[model samples]
Every structure is written in structure tokens, then in C-alpha cells.
Target chain A: MSYLAFQLKKVFKNKLTPVCLAILLLLMGTVLFMNVRTNPQFSLQAGAKSEIAYRQKEINRQQRLLKHDKQKSKTEVYHDTKAAIKQNQDAVKQDKQVQKAANKGNWRKAYTIMWQQKKQEQTISSNGQDLAGINSRINVEKKLQFFNYLHHEPLPYESQDMPVTGWQFLLQLNQQYLPYVFTLVALFLLTLLLTDSYHQKLDTAQLLPLEKNNLMISNTIAGIVLTLGSFLAINLVLFIVASLIYGTGSLAFPYIVGQYTGGRPLIECISTGSFIIKVIVLQVLTFIFEVVLVQFLARIFRDKLPALLIAILLVPGLNIATMIVEPLRKICAWLPMTYLNAVDIVSGNLGMNYQNVQLNYTSGLLTLCCSILIITIMILLSSYIKYKE
Target chain B: MLTVQNLSLKTRQPILHDFSYQFAPGQFYQIAAENGSGKTSFLRAVTDLIPASSGKVLLDGKPYAKNKRKLFFFESNEWLNVNLTSLDYLKFVKRQWHSNVDLDQELDLLGVREYVKVPIKKYSLGMKQKLIVAMYLVSGAEYYLMDEITNGLDEESRAILYERLNNEVTQRNKCIILTSHYSSEIKVNNLHRLVLHKQKMHEVKQ
Candidate 1:
């Protein structure tokens, strides 16, 4: 049998592997059910409709006042009210057209109209409710556009019952919990598989009819296979389970990427499908890089526990390190650990809350690639020297 | 045949200095040394487990790189995983050497037949030692390097190991290099002894 197959079989036999797998599924299931319960899918469509209804009622009231014989002379409040009524009427007329276009599956046009509506709303007032209404219009229109892009249909919106999208639920679940789950799997299950050669005295492996490089490469491949396999499998399972319950949401939905500015919050969004894909790719790269790292540390320490602890702690440690250490903060974009928190890293919001060090997807990908290259070289060199002696 | 020329090893200090030896088929050598006197380092240096400061080791006049599969080295039971059963470890070693040796027969011979399926962690030190010896014996390699693996075995187990060592050297015509602090425990006839003192070997008359 191939070495990778052998290693995989060995990994399967490990008690930790099964335990960690069970934990992963349980954690995902719990998070899915909990996120479904709370964060009750806020209705963007409802917010917009309410705004329109409010404006129309205000317009009717102002028209009635203009016709009534209450006072001949108009006060400043009355004139302001009259102007507001006209603006509201025009805004409502434009939004109705946008809604009509949206219902006809023209989400992009709807989004454009909502953006204009927001600009119009901003010009009139910065009142929180008005801001929220405009924001809702844009957000809902974008979701509808995404729904169309993903499934090629007008978005079927939720009313009081707020229908939760399965894909959206899974995506939210992943954004918050995947990193921790990935870390646990890496630390508890995968690290031991790699480090056991030194720690548990599996050194008898040296006598295997394979060369040192082949042995190390085979082990690394086995690790990648397991790590990537478990990560994808967990996601796939959650997707199916969630889809069955909540209905698969649009992949084209906007992901709310957040950044902090001087104690204030800023939010923007990108395509959900691309966002999820980017995260998965980066996270897989991170697992491979971490596998190499653990192997390297095993070679140095010649013990599993130390290597395991170091590899597991290194990710979050680096994230915090970038905060306290200015130099590390500056170069965090080039550091592999910065990419471990995939959601934040991909959105350039990794250290926004703490240090404001922006990390883009491209930089995170490039940095992780460089780390993999360097670690691969180190592993090969170590194996060669080991065999050469 | 195995040959070592000008072998020296150092880790911060000279662990072994200019050590050298040769062994033909059908020979077993017991290398003895005081603790920290470089006996383990010498065997490790010979097997390329650890790098030599200066020297070359050859199996049949070819360096270890060429005939690595024919040279078997085990440092005590360091390669044994306690989580694995005796039978599993035997199969693992058998695979490493690409052999068809029946692991159960080896286990029976080593007196671990009753506990072959039990985890090594549950076994006594002597049982663990016997299993290690059984594993190495099944390797069928032309040259065997053992580093102080028989330390905890009982007299019966040690005798079994000695008899197997004799068979490998006499019947199979394989070379065996083993290390021990108590050289008297080795009962193989026609034996050769190398004592390490202060980083050098002194050949003792057999």
C-alpha cells in the first residue's frame, strides 16, 4: 500500500481522531441550531416597506393640512413640513418603481435605485431611523441581487416569519466558528499523527524500506489529506443539514465586512460565494502550513507534547503578538498566522478592532504561500541531512 | 559485512573519538561502555542515526545510503509505541523490512504468546523487551545494530534473545552489533567484545 494510505489508516486507528471528529460535528450542529434560534434573520425588506409606508402617511397628512382652513399664514415648521412632504412623495414614487423592478427580477436596477434613495435620505436627515431605513433598502436590494445571481430569480423575501437561508446560516456559522474548530482538529488530532514518530517512539519507522524524504513527504501528504478532508467534510455535512432545514440561501448575498475607525464601526460587503471560497482556500493553506510547522518542531524538540502545544498556540498568539509588538504588526500581512482567522483576514479587518493593521486577501494568500514554501524547504533539508548522515 | 573507518562523534564535546571496527557475517560483537562514555553515540554514528564528525561506515563496502534496507538499528525500545499491541508492532516491523516472517511465531518464541494482542503499555518491561527483540529478529536484515535494548529483560528472556542472536550470526551468517553495560549476560559463543573508555574502544580477547 502507499505511504499516504498507510498513514491515513494509522490516523484512523488513533483514538484521538475519532474523538476530535465527533467534537467537530457536535460543535457545528450546536452552532447551527443556536445561530438559527438567535440572530433571527432580520427582515431588510420589511424595514424598507415600513419606511415607504411612513413616508406616504406623512405625505397624506401634509396634503390634508394644506387643504384645511386652520391658519392663513404658514409658520417655519409648516413650510419645513411641506418641503419634507414633497421630498417624501418623490422618494416613495422612486422606491415603488425600484420595488416593481426588483419583483420583476431586476435586482441590479433595484440596488441602484436603493443607493440613490440612500443618498437622497442622507441629504434630508441623519436621523438614525432614516439612516437605518436607507441602509435596509440597500442591504435588502443587494440580497435580492445576490439571490438572483445565485439562483437566477427575484429574492423571495421573509415577512414576519423571517425565512432563514440555509447557505446564509452555514456561512454565518463558519465565519464565527470554523477557525476554532479547525484549530482544535489541528492541535488535538492532526498534530499527534505527525509528531508521534518522535514522541511515542515510532522511530522504528526509520527502518521502512523508504528513504527519509519519501517518508517525510508521505507523512506530510497524509496530514494534508486528513486535515483538508475533515475541514471540507464538516462544512459539507453542515451545508446539507442546514439546507434541509432552512432552505439553501443565495451564494451571491453580500457578506458584511466590518472595520473599526476611532471607536466607530464601518461596514461593507462582498459576494458571499467568493468570500466563502476564499476563506476555505486560505484555511486549507493554513492547515498545510501548520502541518509542516509541527513536523519541523517535532524534529527540533523530538517530543510530541511540546510541538503540539507550540503549533496550536502559535496562531492566536501571533494575532495578539501583532498587537503588542509594533514590528510584527507592520509585517503581519506577510505572516501566515495573520491569515488563520480567515473571515477577518480576507476582509482586511483582522486587527481593525485592536491595532488597525489592515490585512487583505491577496496579502494573506501570498504570505501563506511564502510560508509553505519556506517550511517545505526546511522539511526537505532536514530529511536530507538526516538521510545523508 | 560491515565496516567503520575513522568514526568520531561530538556533541559540544568529543563523545566518540576516532572509533573504528569491522565485522564479517556470522559474528556478534558486544560493545560495552560506562554511562555517557559514547557507546550509544558510536552505534548511532555507525548507523548514520547521528552524524559523525569524521568517519565513514559501510555495509559490504557500500555506504549506509546504498544498503540502508539491509542495516537494522533500534535504540532500546525507543521505536516501540506503547499504544500499539505486540502483534501490530511486529507487523509494522515486518512491513518495514518487506518480510513474510510470521509475527505469531516470533511472539511465541519470545514468550509473549499470551499477550501478543495486548497493548505494550500494559506489558511488563521484560515483555516489552522481548517484543522488541522479536521485532528485530524478524527483520531479516544482514546487519543489526542494537543499543542497550536488553536492559530490563529477565534471565529467561535474555537467554532467548542470546540464542536468537547466535542463530542470526551462526545459521543466517548475519552480523550483530549490540551494546550492554553487563556483558556477562550475553551467552553467545565465539563472541567478540569492544569496551569503550574515555571515547575510545579497547578490544577484549574473546
Candidate 2:
């Protein structure tokens, strides 16, 4: 066997990589299954209905108050008529003064006097039973008018029916669940690759031809294979679980393609085939970048504890730092984490506008080329150092 | 046959300098030195495991740089992946060398075949050392550069190794060059002993 093949076989024989992949698949499968079972469409419909119902109930309460006030007003109309006329005249005078003061920029003083006058008028109006009934009836009438206005307002959905396409549903499911799966897989593979040698302390490794270089290369290959395989495996398992629960008919390649591309169905969106290819290529590029980054950390730290600590610190720290700096933010967009969020880019949901930037074939190729070049340089430098030792 | 000419090496400080030596086919050479001596550095330089500031090494009258595959170097501490069982490791090494040597019989002769299916992590220091020697023997290279090959071997394993080395040199006509502190145990009529001192090579006779 060639050296590369031997390295690959050795990696497959490792228990860490496989176990990491299994856990990722299991987690994704469980989350996806639960999400499908919960039926988000049902929840959305329920929420809309509850909001409408609450509004209607408020309108009904106001109508009932208006009916009660109408009956009371008939009994007290004659007794309160003179007092009500006098209060209206006083309120109109106060409104004029306040308006003038507001226009002249002495609004604070004017508001104080207007409030005092309104309180005095309210006390005078409440003195007689007929006056009190008239005031209550007027207030209720105003509230009833407002409620009537609301009743004429449009409902959340005019037809009371919202279609939930299988494709849109699946996309939502992936968005909610894929990130945790990817993170867990990355962590598991990194821990295994970084710690395997330290845990075993195998004496034969040092005796191999070009011992240090070989060991480092083997570990790196193992990490990359493990991560990539786990990623593919978890996604495949998710697809399977989704098919089983949602019915395989809803998961035909065309249906998935259509659903992913805004529900145009596969035949209608044949023009999007190139876009789909670009997405796949971008994903592969990001996977490679992630593997290289993990391998570099493993090589530098030489132990699981420090590797994991540095990984944890670096990921969030870089993200936060990237947000505060313009250049770093642009660079961060090309990072592995950013690429893992590639689905957003495909779905036209990026937070920033990339209108002038051509992030098509050229950008994807450039990212892949740069990642490979950096990884190659790191491997060569490491090998040279090992040979020197 | 191997030749070292005008060799100088340093590990943050000078260890060996202006060192020159030569060995013939079927010859057994012992490198002898006290603590802090350059015995290990000289061996490393010859094997090209460490870079020499100024030196040229020739194997069988040809520059070793041109033909590195025919040279084998062994250190006391073996560096094999412990994830693999001993038998699996032997198969891997055998494949790497691309030789038709039987690793099972070699391990048996070394008294380690019982642990062949066990991981190297489970092997004791002496067992691991024996395995290293077995791997070196199976490598079937023209020149064997060994460092402290007998350090952790039992009396029986040590005797077995000495006999194997003797047979490899006399019958197979291979050159065996090694470093050892146990000068009393090794006896050969065609033995050549060299001591590295004061940045130069000095001949030592027993």
C-alpha cells in the first residue's frame, strides 16, 4: 500500500473518529425527529389564531360597556344637561390656551394649568347622578367607536389558510438543527486525534521511518477523514430520518432541490443546478478548511486539553473581534464557521449586502486554493522541523 | 561499508567535531564513551537523523545522501503507534520495507511472539526493545546503525541478538555498526572500537 493509503487505513482503525461520527449522527437525528414531530406549521397557526381571539375579546368587552352606559344615560339625561354644557365650555377655553402656549414654547406651564382645569371640570360634572351617567356614556361611546374601527381591520391571514410546503418545512428544520451537529462532530474528532498518542504512549511510533513526520501526517489525515466522514454521515442519517418521518415522497431529489430553492420544484428550477453545485463545492471547501484548522491546533498543542481550550477560546473570540473590525469581518466571512453557514448564503439570507462582490465560482475556488496552500505549508514546515530533530 | 569524513555536530553546543571514520563490509564496530560523550550524536549524524554542521557520509563507498533507503537506524526508544497490536505493527513495518521477511518467526526468535497480538502499550520496556531489534533485523538493509541496542534486553534476548548480529555480518556479509556501554559482553575477532572525545575520533583497542 502507498503511504497515503496506509495512513487512511490506520485512521479507520481508530475508535475515536468513528465514535465521534456516530454521536454527531445520533444528535442530529434526534433533533430533526423532534422538530418534525412538533409540527412548526401547527404552532404558527395556533399563535395567529390566539392573537386574533384576544383582540376580538377586547372588542366584545368594550361593546358590553357601551350597552350598559346607554341604559344609564336615558335615566339621567334631564338632570345633567345644564352641568354638562358648562363643563364643555370650560374645557374648550382651556384647550385654546394650551394650544397657544404650545405654539409659543411655554407648553410645560400650559399643560399644568390645562390639567388643573380638566380635574375641576371632572369634579363638577360628577356631582349629579344624571351628569355622571352622561359622562360614562360618552366615554363608552368613544371606546365603542375605537373597537368598531378595529373590527373592520384586516385579519392576519385574509383567507385563514396558510400553505406549508414540504421543502420550506425541511429547510427550516435544517436551519434549526445542523449547527449543533457540526460543532459536536468537530469537537469529538479533535479530542480524539489530539489525545490518541498521549493516551497510548506507543513506543513503536518513534521507531518508524521518519518517525515524527510520519506520526504527524498520520494524525492529520486521520483527523480530516474523521471530520469529513462524520459530516457526511450525520447529514445522510438526517436525510434518512426526515424521509422516514415526513414520507419518502416528500424527499425526492427534485422536491428537495425545489424546496431548497424557494419551492420552485426541481423541474421549474433547473437553472439553479449550477447554484446547487456551487453550494456543494463551497461546503467541501469549508470542510477542508475546518480539518486543516483543527490539525494545526492539534500539532501546536500536542495534547487534547490545550487544543480544546485554544479552539474554544479562538472560535468565539475571533467572531467577536471580527464584528468590531471591518477587515476582520470581511475575512471572517471566509472562515470555516462562516462557510458552515453557507446555506444562508444560498438562501439569500446573508446579513450584509454582497451585490458588487462576485462570490461565485471564482471566490469558491480562491477559498479552496488558499486553504490547501496554507495547510500544505504548515505540513511542510512541521515535517522539516521533525526531520531536523 | 560506511565512511564518515570531517563530521561536526552540535546540540546547542559542540558535541563532535572534525570526526572521521571508516568501516569495511562484514565488520562489527563498537562506539564507546562515558557519560556526556558524543557517541549518540556520532550515530545520529551517520544515520542522518540529525543535521551536521559540516560533514559527508558515504555508504558502501557511495554518498549516503544518494541511497538512504539501504541504511537502517535503530534507537533504544521505539516509536510505533500503540493503537496497533504488535503483529499489526510488524506487518505495517514489513510492508514499509517491502521485504519478504517473516515477522512472526522473527518475533518468536526474539521471545515476543506470545505478545504479538497485544498492543505495544502493553509491552514492557524489555519487550519493546526486543521488538525494535526484531524490526531492525527484518529491515534487511545493507548497513545497520544501532544505538544502545542491548540496554533493556534480558540475558537470553541479548544473547540471541548478539548471535543474530554475528550471523548477519559473517553469513549475510552485512555491516553492523553500533554504540554500547557493555563492552565486556561483545566479542568479535574483526571488531573496531572508536571513542569520540574533544571533537575528534580516537581508536580504542580492547
Question: Alpha carbon lDDT of residue A147, candidate 1?
Answer: 38
The CAPRI-style docking tier of model 2 reads: incorrect
Q: After superposition, how far is residue A58 of candidate 2 from its true place, in Å?
A: 6.0
Candidate number of the best lDDT: 1
> lDDT by residue for model 1 over A185-284, one digit each (tens)?
7766666777766623335456567877888888889888888887777878888887787778767656656554564445565666788888878888
**iRMS values for every prediction:** 3.4, 5.3
Which runs in model 2 stand beyond 4 Å of their true positions? A22-30, A33-37, A40-224, A248-278, A291-327, A333-337, A351-362, A374-389, B61-65, B74-78
Chain A accuracy of model 2 expressed as TM-score: 0.53
TM-score of chain A of each: 0.72, 0.53
